[model samples]
Target: MSDRPATSRVLVIVPAWNEEESIGDTVTEIRACVPWADLLVVDDGSSDGTRGAAENAGATVCQLPFNLGVGGAMRTGYRYALRHGYDVAVQIDADGQHDPRSLLSLLEPLGESDIVIGARFASKDDPYKVRGPRRWAMVLLATVLSRMAGTRLTDVTSGYRVCNRRAITVFAAHYPAEYLGDTVESLVIANRAGCTVTQVPVTMRPRAGGRASHSPVRAAIYLFRAFVALSLALVRKWPAQFEDPVAP
Candidate 1:
């Protein structure tokens, strides 16, 4: 377990969209793994009973009236963390692909950097293979983002990440607000805002239940959108000021 400050307030933010099949179990597992952390599930207008399931599993549900996509739902979580004065916030996927047991590993790096990504590709013991076009796309994104952030990034699209107070504040205000926006664009936003970002090796499990949101066609669309978003992020000027820097 991380030897973080005892006063640090940590929150586990789970963004769900039609993940009723797995959200409950995901919440339960997180509670078991990190019982001290508060849990919040942002239901992005899921058509099923995702909200109720998450609540029943002992998570505070933040229901959106309409579909806002993952990026918007994540922004909502960041806003909540900032408003509640949380010292750290971790983003966990509702699909169960992100292992709750790795939550502590993700938090371990927050002492040295503002953001720590739980990178799947960083793990040597458990090789999670991404075959076909999706694999190629991931490689391209990782290469581009690594150059932009001035650091090696193996899993650019990984959702398992921990962020400190400064990151929460910046994300709450300027998070990307579009489809497939959060991953690449948000990294650029954090780097441009002068927040240090790093990654730790983590093994991921296959989704516990329900269909994957990304089909082959969707993967292609995401790649195109990601490219556009990254390009735009490159041209955007840095904001005049950011949130107060937090001590490592």
Candidate 2:
């Protein structure tokens, strides 16, 4: 556990879309792992019973009018965190691939940095591996982001992460609003905004239910789009701080 004050509010933000089978268990596991933290599930217009399942599992539900992908859903959570005056916020996948037990490890570094990514590839002992084209793509992204941020980043696509108040404020204001935009682009934005970003090794588990949103065809399309986005991010100038307060 972090040495931060007990009153330091921590929120676990789970973005779910048709994850009815696993969202409930994901919420329950998070409660068990971090009993003091509040839970918020961003239901991204899930057609199934995801919102009800999350509510039953003891999480506050934030329903979107339509599916806005992970980036939009997480941005909603960030806005919520800022509005609620939370000291820290963590994004956990609703698919149960992210281990709740690793929350403490991710939070331990938040005292020194604005963001702490729970990196799957950061540990050599971890058996999880990204194979084929995806593996190559991650390597390329990691290399680019590492150079841009002036820090080593092993997992550019990992969603398991913790962010402090400053990070939440920045993200709430200008988070990327496109598909897969939450991963690499968010890091670039954070670094450009003068937020210290770092990573900690964490083991990832197989998804508890449902299939990944990415297929081979989708992955190819994402690669081209990601390249274009990353290039733009590198040249774009950003403000030193976020001035606009997000309205609840």
Candidate 3:
């Protein structure tokens, strides 16, 4: 993160799936931390009362008809932001892992960066550490992506980040919903499409409630998928027309 810029019309998108217990609290906390931004909870086909919880907590809810994972929900949120004339978009988890207070720090680099990632490992005294195969995969991804981006990125898989209009436009048009596409491949697409990416240190909290999508036992699987996503991203490029989503 680098230079600061004037910001207007910010939307905080939270993708929730059966996270009724934490969605309400997450919304309230965000409203407390960043009261100026609009909140959108993309309920990813939750069978529970996630929609009601979010609505009661004072968020606009967009309930997906079925579960499409985090990537799909985030793509929907990006499109919603682009259509609603919002100039900035930020993705925060409904499980309470992403701290809302650090949002301002993440936005600090907006003028200098098109996409800013809230990297957990880059922060001081950060407790959210991944180990085993997952940690190895993260290191590899960060190393490869850092070389590609010409910057040091400690956490390439982080979802806690902010995007300006340029980044939003690119994502709205070509964001993928594949396994690791949202965080990994999407960055590749953005870089290929000529968007600048950077990251800032952020302290993430433990999940307040809800189930985790990945477990320790699944670290090996995640490692494999991460490589696959990276491979596809390296070989493929965003189409030429997506260079500018706002042009008529």
Backbone clashes in model 3: 1
TM-score of each model, in listed order:
0.91, 0.93, 0.94
Encode model 3's per-residue lDDT on 1-248: one tens digit a residue. 22223657899999999999999999999998888889999999999999999999999999999999999999999999998899899999999989888888888798899999999899668888789999999999999999888899999999898999998999988888998889999888888878899999998888899667678769999898888989998998567557445455
- What do the candidate models score in CA lDDT, each in turn? 0.85, 0.88, 0.90
Specify the poorest-scoring 10-residue window by lDDT in model 3.
Answer: 1-10
Off by over 4 Å in 1: 1-5, 213-219, 243-248
Cα deviation in Å at residue 165, candidate 3?
A: 0.3
Clashing pairs in 3: 2-109
Off by over 4 Å in 3: 1-7, 213-216, 240-248
lDDT of 2 by residue, 1-248 (tens): 33334568999999999999999999999888888899999999999999999999999999999999999999999999998899999999999999988888788787899999999888779999767666777888899998877889999889999999999999998888775579888988998888998999999999999987667877777677767777877777888777648654
Worst 10 residues of 2 by lDDT: 1-10
- Cα RMSD, model 1: 3.1
